[model samples]
Target chain A: MTFTHQSGTAPASTEASVPYLRLRAVTKQYPTGGGVAGVDLTVAKGDMLVLLGPSGCGKTTLLRTLAGLLQPDSGAIELDGQDLVSVPTFRRNISMVFQTWALFPTMTVRDNVAFGLKMRHVGKQDRNERVARALELVGLTEFADRLPRQLSGGQQQRVAVARAIVVEPRLILMDEPLSSLDHRIRVQLRAQLKDLQRGLGLTGVYVTHDHTEALALGDRIAVMDAGRIVELGRPVDVFARPTRRYTAEFLGLANVVDVSADGGGYRTAAGARIPDDVIAGRSDVVAVALRPDCVRLSQTDDGGTPGVVRVVEYQPGGVLHDVELTGGARLQALTPVGLSYSIDTPVFVTPEWSKAVPLAD
Target chain B: MGRERVRYPAFAICFTLLLLVPLVVVVATAVNPGAYIKFPPDGFTLDWFTTAVETPRFQSSLLLSLRIAVIASVVGLALTIPTAVAITRGRRRLRPWVSTATVLPLITPDMLLALGLLIMLVQIGMASSLIGLVLGHVLIGMPLAVQVLVAALSGVDENVEQAAQTLGASRATAFVRVTLPAILPAIGSAAVFLFIFSFDNVSISLFLSAPGQTTLPITMFQYLEYNSDPTVSAMSTILIVLSLVVAVVLSRLGGLSHLAGSPTRRSS
Candidate 1:
């Protein structure tokens, strides 16, 4: 299966020479070394940037820094060409939707959405209209009078979103806003959020570990590991052709195989010769990241390499076979469910090597 | 019916009667026509109530006690809330020491605490004055109030306040608009405990207040030392009614339920 980018997508609005949001070597370090390291990034106007990472990967610290909830130890943050690091959190025209929703328990849904406008000293008439519009956007218009405790988890999170956007903040920061909901609700809300983000042309910086969420929502994805963005690209590019093994394996079901420059193509120790067009003249390419879908297992002896299937795990649409070559190297191959293979079955592995992503040493 | 099924309700009724029996006897004696405090009245009359109200000493002491209770409770609450917030948000090390000190007052003998206050205030020449009485009452009420407030402040979600700040509320505004309302029930619970504590206190008043200006409890203790009339019972009935009013207010504010609940919001 191939991952494809959505076609016919608009560029939204990009006006200034500088990116709408720019971070210059932002750093916030804890003594425990778990905080965000020096990081630099940029997101254009009306674009969604997703920071994807595992726990303790500093994605949250970075988001909080942007929201002004956290002060970076050292960095320059600019939004709309204005300095943000010097602004207090309250004075900053940025909003965040927390993972826990964080709705004021005492306030009703309407009041919760209105809270931001009220704090900004909006008039009562304008506040009511904006709150109604925000609540309607989240499909929570009828539940406006209900207290947060009375709402479902999904509903409360939507209220949080409404509250964040009601302020029409210069930048919106969301830290795994859907992580706390049920899987079904997460999927549903994720779709609604994507629609809202695109329809409103919102500029957002979302932090999530779920790759699907990042792909569906972010115009650009930043894959972080160990407090650093190891790879930054669009979701399609980052997933289909990662420049590094860290991001390729972390983001997709890609196998990193060690290889060396051989006669016509790179050859793995397993005696598998992968023919990537990009490696034709490269002498320094040492490995290729192989997506399971890119490699195929067949019953022929000379398809590409000879291997014995060691494990067979069945999935809905595909069957995953782990094959060990004569050189003792193991590689994963995903085939159609109909092309089933039992354990210990000798199979010829044929990889579409040209589609394989060549990784730098 | 099984005894196990009846055990709790039986004990409940017994406990309730044990409480009401005293209230009934006091009310009955306050209306008794006899010259001494007695229950199961011979002939009903409210002359004792009139006599209790007419007595200048009773009037002054009761009024004085009310004034002290309100002032001491309000002042104690103001000090207690900030102190609790400080201890709750400060270093975790500070919490254990403060929590231990608050627990100390509950275990120490009342007379010992009163004695300590007397000596300290007398040295400053504040003993036998209203200020001394208020200080003594505040010292006792503070622990109860602070314990509740500290628990409430810490139990609140810190992120809720941060969310407010992100929505454009300043730190002070966030606390006032978000955290304070979240813990309002706890505040009401603490206030009730402090007010009743100061209102009914006799040991502190006995040791601190001047003879003529003693609180109602202390004044009654002295009155019964010589008088055999039912005036003391009459005053006691009124005090009980006043306490009932405060208890009603506490219930309206959800104070009783709040005090019983663990100081934490039910996480979704």
Candidate 2:
């Protein structure tokens, strides 16, 4: 049987063209002074928006407020144009997958998945059917009668996912749900979660500090710091063209250089002049951020800025040459792993002009 | 390792003997063929046990004690579960004061508490009634109930409750379905503890019981004051055996360590 709404209202359509979830000027201040401050975000139906940040950045606060676990000091939360800030959490029709699986230890896997349906007083037949379907979706059908402690970490997390989605909530909030798992399981579950969200066309907000996760799973990434979204855009766009210094440094491995305007060009603090074409049309560019992968290294000191390699570290994919420029600016360049470069070796570094991002002071 | 292996057995034997000797003497006296409560019984017989069970006063007092213990412990649990939940889930600033207040009765001298309750009950005109006795027992039993329930509730992760609320369960439903089941073992252990405490109490029962409503412990005390019979020894032996049975049953159900906030043991 198709999943039906127990409340007699039509299930929210994944095809609805409007933003399914919106938070406007949401502010919740802790007494000790750092909480979410004026966070404004919108999640369109069927889209996944990742809130990416470090610890203490209030991403979790924003997620909790969206989940109605926290009441914002001042803000309006609307889902499908209904005011959600005033709604009690149980009536919000939003589900969350926590960092810790939070599966009820006393309940079996099937019962855990059926909890939301039981809360809504669905018939036992339908509840069992839906629970079976959800467990099948998460590939935990054989473990239905087993308690949470009987499952491995990944399986427990899968149970958590099944529990969240079995409710068919209008919006799903995940607070670093994959953060606790080991690396391989995290990667596997990340792919599964992304596919599941898209296949069901469920709009979701995912929070994480891991850059690879943000880039891999988010349709759009909102880079946050100090309780504010510093950058918001498509993942590739945000990664390639971060407008803020914080975003450029936080979202990618970047070499940030302090530069000054030099007659229609840019000059580093160490007095190396960067060509006009590399400055990217920003006359006010006080600095340029280059990704380590974008800088090319050559031994002949031709057609680029000359620098001495202070450290040559070997990585699996490539070698990293920590280069100190002639005038004392330092940068890293990625080269082939087998190319031998000892410490104190001289090399010339050239920035790929298209990859240089101009930043405001 | 060698020293520890030898020392641990020695300590175990000494400790076991320390606890077993008094109980052994009581049992020996209860089985003594001669009358006069002598240890290292003159010979074995079940006459004192039969005598302790057959006496009308002993029978009535034992039944009264059981009734009071069951009723008072059930009421104590009812009063303390909600209070414990509130104190644990309430404001951070209020927790310490509330906790200290809940446990105040446990630290107070039993004589002082009983005297205070007697005066209060008399002024309220409930003195010497069974209701007054149960109320007094509840006051004394509440601390144990609160301590056990509070530890159990604290062991529960708050996120699971929040998760339930987000899953469309009202606050009350979440508590009953999730929070309550998570701590049920602790609650059972607490009720048993309160029952035993109320059953064994003498001071509060001494002050609260009226004529014909004497509890078993108070009756035993009064009997020992004037009599040299082994019946009191027989009663003590029965009480000890009852406590041991309760302990064994509780362990079989689920151990009491979970009430002390160890992680809940899952039966896989």
Top-TM-score candidate index = 2
Q: Which residue pairs collide in model 1, if any?
A: none
The residue ranges of model 1 lying beyond 4 angstroms of the native Cα positions read A1-17, A257-288, A298-316, A321-331, A341-355, A359-361, B1-33, B38-47, B256-267
Among all candidates shown, the one with the greatest DockQ: 1
RMSD of each: 5.2, 4.2
Model 2 residue runs over 4 Å out of place are A1-17, A262-265, A277-286, A300-313, A324-329, A343-354, B1-9, B253-255, B264-268
List interface RMSDs for the candidates, in order.
1.3, 2.5
What C-alpha lDDT, on a 0 to 100 scale, does residue B257 get in candidate 1? 51
Give the fraction of reference interface contacts each candidate recovers.
Answer: 0.72, 0.79
Best by lDDT: 2
